[model samples]
Target chain A: MSASPHAAGSTETRQVYLFATCVIDLFAPQAGVDVVEVLERLGVTVHFPAAQTCCGQPAYTTGFPEEARKVAAAQLDLFPEPWPVIVPSGSCGGMLKQHWPRLFADDPARRVQAESIAARTVEFTDYLVNTLGFRLDAPAASGAPLRVALHTSCSARREMGTLGCGRALLERLPGVERVEHGHEAECCGFGGTFSVKHPEISAAMAADKLDALTASGCESFVSADCGCLLNLNLSLEKRGAALRGQHIASLVRARMDGAAS
Target chain B: MSAASLPQADARVSPEDFKQRSHESLHDAHLRQSFRGAMDFLVERRALQFPDLQAFNTLRKLGENVRQHALAQLPDLLERLEARLTELGVAVHWAETPADANRIFLDIARRHAATLMVKGKSMVSEEIGLNHEMAAHGVECIETDMGEYILQLDGDRPSHIIMPAIHKTKEDVAAIFHEHIDGAPLSDDVNELIAIGRRALREKFASAKIGVSGVNFMVAETGTLALVENEGNGRLCTSVPDVHVAITGLEKVVDRLEHVLPLYALLPKSATGQAVTTYLNLITGPRRAGEKDGPREMHLILLDNGRTQAYREARFRATLQCIRCGACMNHCPVYTRVGGLSYGTTYPGPIGAIISPHLMGLQSTRDLPTASSLCGACGDVCPVGIPIPDMLMKLREAGRHSVAESITPPAQALVGQGSVRRAGEVLAWRAWRVLYSHAALYRLFAWLAPRLRWLTPAWQGGWTASRAALKPAPRSLREQLARRRAGRTVPGR
Candidate 1:
């Protein structure tokens, strides 16, 4: 495997560790597979530690700091080595990079481990665009006729600055056109535990996302985060709307495979 | 009238009522759609500007310290600020209420023989009903902030704290401008819309006898007033008019310029995601000698209006530390979902929910506290680390206590235990004991008896008629657990 998408005839491949988020692990394993495949194809050694578990975001968001610490400690123990731990989901990645250090501040041992992990943690799109400088390889199609709207997850857009990367990757996809939605940066209301705690707010925010998506007249919606996609999809289902939501990786993977055969 | 004879008001909505209203508002299709879109825009824009939370937090801490230090010595600083302003030939007035503040400004305008007042964006002005009060006295106050200008033309209150007309779409703004601006061609372009406002307000700025503005921070050391804005209209408003008047909350003051930097860093980022507002106009003692532009006469009105009360309460003092950057509203799940109009107050969202009740009184704005879901997102995002959720709970308690005090003794007795023995009476009452022990049977009776008028008392039936009781499951969880412990299958299973 080459170290990067641009790396050709390489003598050495960079080692990349995958932190398959809980949602991806249980619900959408294909997203994890897509991540691994994309990384491996881009000339990187992919490692998936079987011991990896939840990022403790669920516990932390729910105000259970003690339970969150336990989960964070376990994650720290699992990823002891210093390698870039690229995560597909920005929410989980944010928990590791931003929240874990704060969660373990009282414990010196855990804090040190969390800090080390945070230093190496990066969201997948950000890693590809910033670190690897993986420019979009495909050209915009002249006239295949597709209009795609992008819904940026709160974690990806707010916690992580992956908006440019998400947009860039989408704009490069063949036969796809981009339409900017008003209030595109707003939360889809899928704030992890917030969805269950305040389902009303979550549902309201999701409905707002769907409205913007529908207003854009986009055939399909693309987002970088799966949690957003799932919540948005649920909102769409509730309203009996027929709009498709896809992860950026899924779209990229499909694009790479030449229009889904 | 005596306090007891002030005309008893109905009890504000209960927490249960607020929850139901919030739930309905959240699921409302149009509301949800609009909120999601608005939140996404703010979140994306903010992230692009401030990518590092650690850096943001550091700046936020510094800002908090500055506010806290200033608040600690507020009396001394206010005196010092007055002395400096007086030395510069500017008048300073202290107003204890909205009426006092409004009267003070109107009196200043009257003394200046003012006709048209060129006003910049000031939430305090809104708080005191300055425009309405001035208008009632036949004074025209034209808003200079572009967002405020649009809302003023459309005759609407500000919807968002920083972005006042955030609820208005480009088309809505275009229509409002076209209708109000004497046949100016309507355009959806924001810059074009601003240009239209600029042209319309240019005459007002030049000919206006008096100008009114809001200070983001008031520095005590040099008696300098700071106004941060993107439009530069604040500068125009302060400089162009012959007389300039600033009305601001007393909480806006700081000890010195040294304390203003961290706040400068945090305010813009939290408000509009800008590294810095386009204009940070620092006016020290009005215009110095030989100045070409700036007010010949300057006045700063520091309005307290319940801030002293808030500052006295240890639990609520942190509220005074709010710089009003409005990040709390911007990131609030409830605020975005329900929109600002639902808040029914000048300040909206998580911050408003906590502060409005205290400022407006518990009875007037009691619904504010119950609007939150206790999601804790607002507390996390607060730059000053204001425990918004905790404060909200306290406000709810205050509301309940106020309600209990005001109601008839019989009504109050229904909610409260009159004496120490009454508590035991409540717990040991056979009906109440049975209701507690058998949750399922209690819920079933509650649901079924609402339909049977003969079985329940008029008061209890009236309460049930007004609000639906909780639907009980066939089997209680405790009963199911007990059956499971006995190694028997439950009926439902």
Candidate 2:
């Protein structure tokens, strides 16, 4: 989306294309809505093309190269403009920004389109902090601060190199205190389809992740990707833990709108 | 366990068992606490020094190009290196496997009439299980590297690449030294610990008839073997003995000194947060007649093992770019927390996870590919820009296919027949939907699903284990759209 909440110009007025990820589309539509609301509040005009489908990450990761190429071709055709594609989910954004070029190696036309799109695509938090130069409003040291734990999704932390951005932004929210989770960068075991394919190993990994999260002693947890949040929430809920989960965008929006006390 | 009493197969643990054991072992309160402390220390130390090392990307690119260029010209460089070493009166040997490499080294030892062999830190030797092999052949082998020597005394495999004894606390080292070193005063003081290791290895360095060491880099231009180490053991192991043997992977060859300089700069910085190690020894075919301290007779064993096979494949050839800096392992979230013993390979962490399956075969290490969360941190922190995550995925595909092929007769029959029948049903279902209205048939099938629980397999049943309960969608998309057009709420709502 556009820059920070307090930028000189109206970021909400700027035009942004929302790349609604397939997982969010099918499972967690509220995350996509939250992204739109956050962007609009920051003064950005959001556009969601109905023609947008899957980012081909499912097929691509499953080793179906031919099917992935078909999906990439359709995606390239669907998003033809040069405007920045703001992706709400880190995994989809990472796939489009980093992996699309490798998907269509033989086709020159699609490869060029993939490269152009990748250059303009940005993860939501990184775009807000780096591109928009958003300065965080430091919360006053008053009242009881809510302890929050941060999890950096694998794609966003390692692929995008924004390991600290989410935590940095969360610390700025009023009445929120960020606690470091042990093995915070470890996988949440939500690797798409990996959970279903190898449920034993996947569940074991999720248990380890939950243990680390619980060790942080934070009542609420936040992560950069919706997929990780969903997997983590499911695990927590299954264990009957009352830990709250929220996306960083929603937290920032809440702070901006003065909804969080 | 004593060296003589140790079981042979215990050294080679199966990957499945390794994963289960590591998962169990990592949960130990003491081990987890120690690992957390060590990982935090390394991460903080590394972060402070390279807070914004902008040139890291450039260095990685250069390292990648240099390695690729070296691998492309490997045959020519090997020939030239052999020729130059021959000119200097040194022998060169090539071995394709651990047995062959060990036989070559033992043959040299036998020819020299050597009873004692002093060794520096050599991961290749570890890969081949050379230490136990040498001991089995009645040749007493002593580890000269301080970390290696401590691990040797503790009767354990290395747990970290650069820092082999990283898992051991100071108290562990003290206990090890107290047990092994006869009448030697033991202390946990870091310098005293160093002194104990130095005192123990000094006698081996002087009395050993032959020396063995691993090459950090090999310069093809001058036939030089470069050994980089923080301790001076590598220097002693390469120079003090009458007969010296240097073993290295074929992938270690570089074109010239200039190409290795940038790598040398990046290696120590990334590995240990040091600008340079204590010693960077370059031996050009061992000792000349005028040289006083160097070994009189030198031998170079360039072992291929499985490296050449990996190098030939374009997709995996990037793995050869690894300089063994251990930076990837240091930063890896999985490797850091679980420790290296969990990997059950000579090289541990991200690099090992990718390359070991190729070298050891997919069937043996099927579990390693699934070890990662596919975090891509290894690729980012790699000094040589290896696409480690991509390689791991490829390994996973290979593992899955291998597993599918290896399924038992009954399992295979069930899967084979079920898949074909399912395929036909799916095709027929799609065809029927396109040709006619199948809304009633779909509703009937959906209604019967919950009653027919026996049709689902255990793995599929496990998929819904976390869900509150499985429930069918109220209406199809087309029906929902029609309902919206009529301005009526859907049935589920």
Top-scoring candidate (DockQ): 2
- Per residue, candidate 1 scores C-alpha lDDT tens digits across B1-493 of 1112211212232333444556666556675566658766776677777788898778777877888899888888889889988998889999999999989988988888886798999999988877777777777788899988888777777767888887778899999888878767979998898888899889888889998999999988988899999988999999989889999998888999888888888788777778888899999877778977788889999888777767766757788888888878877767876777666677888888776755666665655665554545676667677778667755544443333332111222211222112233223333433432343554454345434534334332211222222223333322332344367354321
Best by TM-score: 2
TM-score of every model versus the real structure:
0.59, 0.82
The top-ranked prediction according to lDDT is 2
Interface DockQ of each model:
0.06, 0.20
Per-residue lDDT over A146-216 for candidate 2, one digit per residue giving the tens place of the 0 to 100 score: 78788888898766767667766765565788888776767777676666644544665677788888888
List where candidate 1 sits over 4 angstroms from the true fold. A1-261, B1-32, B402-493
lDDT of 2 by residue, B1-493 (tens): 2346433324665554656666665566677667667766766665565666677777768888888889888889888888888988789989888899999988988988877899999999888888889879877778888887888876788878788988888888988888888766768898888888788778888889999999988988888888899888898898899999989898899998888888887788778877788999988876777867888889888888778757766766888889998878887766765678877888888888877865776566666666766767778778788888898765554443322432121221211112212344335333533222233443344345434634545433444565222222333222333344367353221
Least lDDT summed over 10 consecutive residues: which range in candidate 2 chain A? A135-144
**Which residue pairs show backbone clashes in model 2?**
A11-A43, A11-A44, A12-A42, A12-A43, A12-A44, A13-A43
Which CAPRI tier for candidate 1?
A: incorrect
Candidate 2 displacement at residue B461 in angstroms: 7.6
In angstroms, the error of model 2 at A233 is 2.0
